[model samples]
Target: MSTIQFTFAVFLLMTCSSRVHSQICEAGWFGSKCQFQCHCTSPCHSITGQCQGKSTCLKGWFGNACQYRDLAHVSSCNIVLNPRQPFSSWVTDRNDSTCNEDVTLESVALSWSTSVPFTWMRLTLNESVILRSLRVSFTSKTSSNATCIDTKLYLINNKTVDIRCKVIVDTTSVIIEGQGVKSLCSLYINGGRNVALKQNSAQTSTYTSPTVAASASKAVDGNTLGLLSSNTCMRTQSSDTCPNWNVTFDQSQVLTAIHIYNTNDAFPVCSGRCGLQLNKFSLESFNSSGTVFRYQDHSTTFTSLYEVTVAEMASGIPVNGLRLGLNRTNPILMMCEVEAYGECVPGSWGLECKKICADRCSSQCHVETGSCPVCNDFDDRSSCHTGCATGYFGYDCSQPCSQNCQNRECNSTTGLCFSCVDGYLGPDCPENVTENIEDHLLILITGLGVGLGVSCAVIASLLIVIIYLIGRGKQPLKESKPSPDYIQRDSIGTGTMDSHGYQIYVTPVRPYQNVSNTYIKVIGDAEVIQPPDTYINVTTKANDEHDDC
Candidate 1:
């Protein structure tokens, strides 16, 4: 109980403190004294320094340590169907919602015979795996002969056996295959159907048909041969009974090689007199330098035709005599085979080979004339070139012309000039009338002359009437005279007059007189005399001696 005991107790205490400190600091360590590795709580992880909840991963991150992953990235998985090759492998298994990545499977080879139905391999995914979507490429091998066959797809899950089923060709029905060991399965068929398994045992499995309908036709004829149609060739005649379609290549089209497939027979048709018919076939070729070689009605035949070498048809061509076919009309009656052979004429190469010839002339020759066609003339008489003039427009170039090309001919093609109409000649119709100015002036002068002549004649007639009236004046008859002595007053006024005691007076006039005149006379003793106002006066008096006294 002395120094040794005290030291031992101190050592134990220090060891416990250090262990507790380590547990609190280190993320991977846990427990009261940091003695055991701790399991992470919600959002707190041992691997990732940060945590939010239990077993949850963030976007663009997965697993421990918050490591970046491509789980959330958008992706496209494309599967292409190759007509040359066929595949019988599991295409994809990406139907589970948990599996967000896209998966695709495609069949490269087309099946020729429906008698031997094509079997698509089963696709299986682990029960724990999650998928988002699936895509597939299923190309038909049917040509003019063989028919297409229906294919079935099946999916299995170990966990959910009750929902696992086989998808039928019709896609409307699903057969329960029973759950065995796996669970959570999905199936997708290209150009066929889809089948999905449900989690509940009481629920039924659902079937979904393909979004795109598959072609329901055959691939080959009775001879099992598949005929390849040329994109540039024209069909001369087509027989409904025969499985093959006859196409004629343009005589001006450069002959490359051809591709022929025999669906019924696997053997190649290269060793026969059977090839493309070059009778009356013509072509034009273009070289790498763009030089062109035109050949008319040149004939060619092909002797060697094989499967592997037929791809040479797309290569450069001098393709005069390339042909590959069977002696019979149906070379591909038994098995589908392909034959492609041709060579461009000298100087012809690349995609430009066919376009060069088409630029100069069309594949079909002119009917009746049988001549190579040229661009139609640009004159007004030709319909092809009958367009708007430079300044004029409409069908016949008859319209009110614009001001841009006044008095000028409009280029019929562009309609950019101003041209005058026929009757109304001017820079732009009536705008500029320089040519007719003199004529208009002459018309005005003539009108003025006619007006002056009419005026003079009227004046002359008026003068003649005045002279006749003066000459015919004063042709009077005999007249009687008024008595001189009797005085007569036309009007009376309101004034009085007294002379020599003889007085005459009148009342004031009610209405003023417009005009009045007075005459006065004086008579005295034995004499009668006129008064000083004899012209006209307001008074008149008679002078008598006796009346004056």
Candidate 2:
């Protein structure tokens, strides 16, 4: 063979080998190969390979000579036909650049209605496969009253879709009016089931259905219904019979489960089954006889033997009453939902009566606890000094003292005062001293003064006696004047005489002798005296004798 022919042959062989290796599957073979199977039934292009016929197109391989398959490319088949309408809009992640290119499918448009306020939308996949996520853009005119817009993604029949709805204004706002949609696979209406309606705030009726009536021919249960029962007599109808079969419970029982079922498959409506008429069904309990618990005013459409509990029941003693009656005026009854069991406890009627009595007494008597201490006969300030007023004493200062106290009043709490009785002194009325305190003090002062005076007198008397005794014990002072018969003599030769009868003498100087300078002489019948140099001489004799010197 020529050299060129040889090279061409080699290249041709290599190309054929590569093409064969790249093919998704060989003829008559199946399963994963270099490319995915398009379920085509015809031949495909050999070079720059593209399939022309529909059958070939279905069989063709488009990626790197069918070495790789991209599932993301499957979105190319989703074509949004009508893209420009007020209520609907189209969305695309990429620009439309390959409209005429047979090899490239790069973009897809999402078509949806903007007028319907729905939170989510779904689309079914071409094949039965699951989709994980989807992207969406909004194009709806915002409502003035609407606060927010929210979008959600849904997988329907294994395809991803978008949904949009208005966000709730507040948490209290009711959303999802009817029973929630059957499954996640279903499309949401207006994005969701939330419907805006005025909340009912009026007080409900107190009517209740008879227990017997409530237990009567339910499409679901044939047995008599018993909820909560107490020993007390059940509430009675006007006929005075215990409302048979009716049950009542406390608020805590509101959330209990109730079982109900319907034989009919037809859904109840507002007029027939969805209206407020079913709310008339009553619950009754003997423990709270005559007291109606609640009156329903809403409609419910449940047909299955289901269970539900009211959410408003509280957690204390059951104050609920139940009865059974129809509000045919509203004409609504389709057995869609029925309640059989609930979590409500029976109440004690006797206890309620006792409580009422206690409350009434507490309000009327206004009596406080604790007794007032007894009052003392005398003024005592210990017990009721601050709590009670004078002259009043009792459990609550509501009573007066029996005996009248003298100059003393009773305290309200202790029936005692701080003052003593009249004509009495000291803390208690111990003494009846007529003297005033001041007068008594004065008397005491007088007694003290008298004691002092007596003490002074005794001292003076003792001094006088002591002086007299001392004088008697000692010699008396010499008489100031000598008797007239006495005589006086002087050493200096001088003499004197007493006035009555005495003689005086004067002598020459004498050694060591006391002498008088002057002397008095009397001539009466008295004796005479003479003075001598060493001796004075004087003599007196009988009538015949004469004195010699």
Candidate 3:
């Protein structure tokens, strides 16, 4: 090989090695080989394939690997429509699987106004969501044809879509319109779960006889059969003055509307009046506090409506129970089925209550819309989070922090200062609690003086007791045996000597009486004057082996 060829070969090898070593995957790609697609809401780690950023997987995706998808959540959605046409608002009502294409007595349908050939309905969502598929069951003006010919969905980015068409796009709002759309029998966006399915139910009185019985729970049994003989409808006893029925949800629910399927008893015995008897009734909702809010009035006369829809109050009322009862008069009330559809309780939103409310919301949020009724601050109207800045506090952050607060820092929710300045006290730091330092020192000195006086009194009492004991004279000393060669002295001693110059005394040991071990000796000078009461003399001869004193 030539020199130039060898150098070129080495450089090419190094370049290839560098490129291979720095092989980085794109944003959506993960795994060691970068062959797997990330299903996270943000991005995933390139090597471990774990969700990054918030570490949360995308909607409907779960598990540590984010490989499994919850089809039930991915396919469920609630429609929020802003009607631009004169059509009734019933078009946005949620329907269950029991509803079919045909407009039956139990199927609620929205009829399009024939005055407008083209109609548009704009959908508004609380947050941006992935668009799945739109399901609209359009009925025909005639028996053999479909009226909705040019049904188109307008995406946020000005993209057009067809009915029931697959769409994977992030959108906050969309417009839906159809050319020559005669009537909408049923409308479903993706799919939604019936939160009121098989919930607890009760009525004022149940119709009971020897052959059959109808309870309040029958209305929520997911059966739309309206026949009286089917035993699936709920009926109140005829004797009850005010027939009433209610379904209490296990958890609190924020309902937008409720669909009531009236019993359509088509029998020869009852002339066309079975379904008509359900008229002149009202639909009401109540919470645990017994606060009732009527959603539908008793004046409604559904001449041909076997399926009645009661729209809830604005902002989606949070309720635990729904009531259906006669108003102003006693009438028989019977319903085959009832479905209350909306988002779950507060603190949660979205399908199956999987989405959490924004942490900024000081109070609960609107169930479907995720709007906070009470935001933490006022600066950011779009969000409940973003609490008040350094010097601001209170609702919407309108109020300023207290002047007494140190550094002007206070609680955003309560508008109270976290800590007060030197002299101020309390949450708002409004009360002045400062006192003079000299007064405090005076109190300390007084306390110390009292303590010293008490200690001196105790010491004086102890000294008196000691002096009295000493004046009573000393007690006798304890005696102990001494060695033969040593003299033992008693511990009790009087510090006084006799008038005599010297005195000597000897005493024999009483315990040692054996003649071999006993001896005594004493010497006093004849010149020394000895007091007879204080002196004693003794002599002993060792050879005699006897001693006396």
Candidate 4:
């Protein structure tokens, strides 16, 4: 190195070394760079920079410095149960989980027409949610009419709570169960905000299916019962291969128990013949990924339902779907329902969470499988904190029960049709008219048939009588009259045989006995002549055989 450059380099090194030794961390802060915040009640040690008394970093912040960073938010006990998260792969919640939505509370109430104006409204949330507060609003005319509003909460860990408050009018703020909860799934509000809201309750449901076999089903459709029994219950395929039923869920669960319902009243005889009544079957549960857990069962009681506890779970294995198989499907391998108890699927609430709930439902139904961890009855899958009220029916609960219906109430599913009016039929109840032309026409047709049959019988008898009269007229009757003059002429007659085996009669004439005036005489069928009456005897012969007879 050059002489001047070397001297400058040494000076720089000495200055940097001195500054490094003199620098020290601030109070409540420690680290080589002096950036860490400590969790100390008092000042930290000067050399080691350790907290003097209390624990390091109050729940959130870490390191030696009291940085006021929230570590608790990061280390919070919220274990994400949704395996489909990071939200990219899911339909809901691509953004953060906190979705603050403003919704119209008008549609969620259970409503039906009544003879009396019994106006009430209700609202239920979809999934269990941590409640911040509730905001209510009313119009000038409605606030005076509403009676009360009720609320229900379903915690994610399977707990339920209720709260009710009288409507004090205007927009009132209320707290539901008053606490932060473990993934709350549902909320509810009853009684209308206004009286103008007179309409039928909507019962809506949404399904987040995973390649369901609706189109792939062989027989016995995939409606209400298809989810439980993937196989055709009453029918068998040509090949006797054991049909396997499979179901896939949206997330994984730690399975503890299972329930299987066989083909019930549907095609009872065919179910028996087709092996719809299960004898020997095997079940396999799969995780969110395709890993599996297996079990086997054999019974002969012909039960419609079967419940079994999982033998291989202390803490339980994560499961998302199940595979049911049969050893021999003489008729068919069939089931009516399949239920698994495990960690609840996300976007679902209440018990085992098999219900299809969505914002479309105006009312929700309480599920009866397990203690609700999060959502309440019929949660709205479309809206996390939105769902139909209880006892409402239809997609948006837009159709109401009949005004004449009892209590103005109807089934949430079947609606008023379940207990329809006296003269009504169908789900929508098109009126039944009293005077029916079809009945009259049927009666007329029957009368015509009877008249035609009677006429045919009478005509046949007349034809038979006419035919007898005509045939009798064509025949002649015979009557014999004896010839009066022939009896006095014959003296004696003799019979002779002819070639035709006919009898001929002969008569003898004596010459002295009678001589005609001219010595000639004619008889009936013969001519006789004698010569001059000179002792002549002549024999007369008959022209026809009748003369001999």
Q: lDDT scores for all predictions?
A: 0.27, 0.28, 0.48, 0.36
Model 1: lDDT equals 0.27
**Cα lDDT, model 2, residue 132:** 15
Top candidate, metric TM-score? 3
The candidate scoring highest on lDDT is 3
Candidate 2 TM-score to native:
0.17
Clashes of each: 89, 57, 5, 44
How far in Å is the alpha carbon of 408 misplaced in model 3? 40
- Model 1: per-residue lDDT, tens digit, 42-128? 434332244555444333232223221211111222322322114322222233333212223222222322211112223344452
Off by over 4 Å in 3: 1-193, 209-211, 266-272, 295-313, 328-330, 350-549
TM-scores of all models? 0.18, 0.17, 0.35, 0.24
* Root-mean-square deviation of Cα positions for candidate 1 versus the true structure, in angstroms: 52.6
RMSD of each: 52.6, 58.9, 43.1, 48.6
How far does residue 34 in candidate 4 sit from its true spot (Å)? 56
Of the two candidates 1 and 4, the one with more favorable lDDT, higher being better, is 4
lDDT of candidate model 4 versus the reference? 0.36
For 1-549, candidate 4 gives per-residue lDDT tens digits of 999999999999999998786567666544444433345556775445566664443433322133322211222212222122332111111112343232322111111121111111112333432123222222222232232233323332212233222222222222112112223333222221110011111111111225322221222121225332343222233244545566555444444455665655444435433334466676666553443556656566566556554442222234556666555534355554455544333233332244544443223322222222222223343233544354454333434555644455654433433444554444344544233335555666665565555556656655675576568884432232323432221111122223323332233221122212121110012122211212111112212221221
Using lDDT, rank the candidates from best to worst. Answer: 3, 4, 2, 1
- Name the candidate, 3 or 4, with the larger lDDT value: 3
Candidate 1 vs 2: which has more lDDT: 2
